[model samples]
Target: MKKEFSGRVHFVGIGGIGMSALAQHLVHCGYAVSGSDRQVNEQTEKLQKIGVKVHYGHSEQNVKGACLVVRTSAVTPDNCEVAFAQKNNIPVLLREQLLGEIFDAFKQRIAVCGTHGKTTVTAMIHHVLERCGVSHTAFIGGEYNKSNYFFGENIVVAEACEYNRSFLNLHPTICLCLNVEYDHPDCYKNFADVQKAFSALFSQSEKVILPSELQKMCDKAVLFGKNGSVQAKNVHVGRGTTFSLYSDGVFACKCRLKVCGRHNVHNALAVFAVAKLLQLPLLQVSQALAIFCGVDRRWTLHPECKFNVVCDYAHHPTEIAEAVQTALSMCKGRVFCVFQPHTYSRTKAFWQQFVTCFDGAQEVIYLPIFAAREKPQKGVSSFRLAQLARQTGLNAKYFSTFGKTAQHLSKTVKANDTILLIGAGDVNNLTKFL
Candidate 1:
């Protein structure tokens, strides 16, 4: 916490997952907090219940009499409240900047950064640390159970995002990079640019933990993978995964995770490495991780009438592949995937990769792209992606509306079929109708 100004803070995009968590934390810290967003949702409703004044739409008056203003990456410079705050000579800070200030208050700060699985990894570490009775605070990117942020003391754990190099604003004594891959095409030019950002984040940390695949990039990093410092051996993947964790060629502990997917095993590997580095109680950490149901929208399962519906926030090509693979492993019958491309830039950038990602799905339905923080680009749409997917000989089709898609699925889907809704957007809401 910076002490220069009084604790009168205003958030620009308050309804966002990250922004709402930050608002709750500030209110818990005895600050006078208020915010404005374009729409009202469950997050905004929660903020209101917690005594944070929230405005539905952006307005110049929303920032009046605030000591400072915080904005998410999605908020543009031309936003009404942001522009008004600047005109009034008020201090305007990005959300990551304020998060860095909050992190500076703690001695042990852990930041989990990667192209995917940051939310799961952060939540896993938080759960383990909490079960071990470690005094810690966590700021997660997605809603975990009920809240996105947990309040504690002495330590802070947060999900570090790499879009626009925002993770650089964080101060992490221990940094965990799950895996570096090309993402956020709207920001980075190529894979090298993405790697450079992760390298910059690694440079700021006193200790770094990453997968074995990236060990060559950072020799000093504590690695975890097929042949890393910490390894998951004798792995079994079923309704869940069971594996023996080894640290430096010695059997450390036997672990089981309720979460599905081989990707989650890799996520658990990173968490186990962190626990070992921190010297937390191994038995308790493993137990807590075993019962971890996972964060919202990360392979969350809803058992409908006869068929099953699984929701996942897999917007990237690699994540989509892993998600489909996980669905295939869990489904007893055919796998039906309803995918919504998150942004136009990403769909355009990873077009070729996206074409082959649905290889494991029996049927693929394309919903309209969810344009988050970006305008539609020329020659970029879900229809084109659907056509490309068909070129790869996958059973793919494009539906312009969710209602029509739902109606079609209701008639075509049968018992024992698993419907996987994959995206980082509102596609998860479709599960309610299904």
Candidate 2:
């Protein structure tokens, strides 16, 4: 093992969900950890509770005592802390590289990858395995209610993000490519460029599982959406989606979800296929999924609100559609869809696609792009998205703030209507008010 930077590690962007989880894991593993982010967030506060010194912003002082300084993909040499690390000759590693090292320690590391539904699938898999008495650790992208079981263990399960080629560093024992799609136009040049990275990872894996749609993308992968391995046939969605798993033949099947969505059924099946491949009992997997409450800020409810309200971390075209359609399918009345585009580049690049994703909403509301790591492009705004949706024959509108969006929804949404606030961004915070 490389022992040059074993004493202390400082994180450059610790407020992010992935960054915070990694920080926690390192602290739990007996590493001296500290970090810096743009602002103080709940995640940073949590890290502080665990005795991690979190600096409010990046600076040379933050990395003072660090033998190693880790930076997120968004961090560049221009970042004060990162530059300081270089000037001081501190061993610097990308976030993925640090995760790769930790993941390498485990024998059964499972990585779930795709353009969308990765979070749900990761949570489903984690839930099933935990219920089946498997001692495993998970680094999910979102917050999950399985608090007692959501933790680190002998087996490391994590959501492998494709942004800036982060997931490529992971060494997975059972790597799951959920489904492939074009995204991250900011980082990757185009769809082919993104696919190239996935192809390389799947090519190197011992057992690669993927949706059948990606077969042409990676020849060696074990396809799942339709053909080679696990297939969910006769899919039905109501109360929850239930479908039979067919490999050589069909198996008697049913699934129940507190969450409603067609995509989630597919997610559950992905979990089933993986667990069964690992020799986990199908019955145990089903029980776990049925009992699993959906992840936090992912279709969560507000306490005082009589109308149905859900908070989801969905921003991509595919993700937005799933959230809206799921809310519509489960509700008795109209569905109000509120969206916050995640980044300027993504909103600009996938503009047309986002317009068509909200197929089932009775009304649509948009918030300014979250701008995860990019400055705003002048022409890219939620109003543009609203206009795009309007062209698609949907009732669309835009708001600059969460308070305004909530106010509009309060007046517009009826008693029986279900409101879905969707985005990977801070749009979910709107739920605190209404």
TM-score of each model, paired residue for residue:
0.98, 0.93
- The lDDT, on a scale of 0 to 1, for candidate 2 is 0.80
Tens digit per residue, CA lDDT, model 1, 1-434: 85456957999999999999889889989999999988899899999998999998888888999999999989998998999999999999999898888887789989999999999999999989888889889999888878899998989999899999989988788999998899998899999999988898888888999898898777679888778878889999978799998888888889999998999899998998898889986778889999998999999887753458899999998999999888888789899999999888998888888778888788999998899989989898889888988887989999998788888899988888889999999998786678
What does candidate 2's lDDT look like per residue over 1-434, in tens digits?
12335788899999877788888887877889999988987788888998999888667888988998888888887798988889989988888888888776788888889888777788888888778888888888777763312565778788888888888788788888888888989889988898898887776666788777767876666666666566677777876666666654566456566666787767776787788678897766777887877878777777666668888877788878777777777789998888888889999988888788988788888888899779979888888789878887999998888788777877888888888888887776787768
Residue pair clashes in candidate 2: 212-225, 314-423
Count clashes in each candidate, considering only residues at least 3 apart in sequence or on different chains: 0, 2
Query: Measured by C-alpha RMSD in angstroms, how accurate is candidate 1?
Result: 1.2
State how far residue 265 of model 1 sits from its true place (Å): 1.0
TM match of model 2 to true structure: 0.93
The most accurate candidate by TM-score is 1
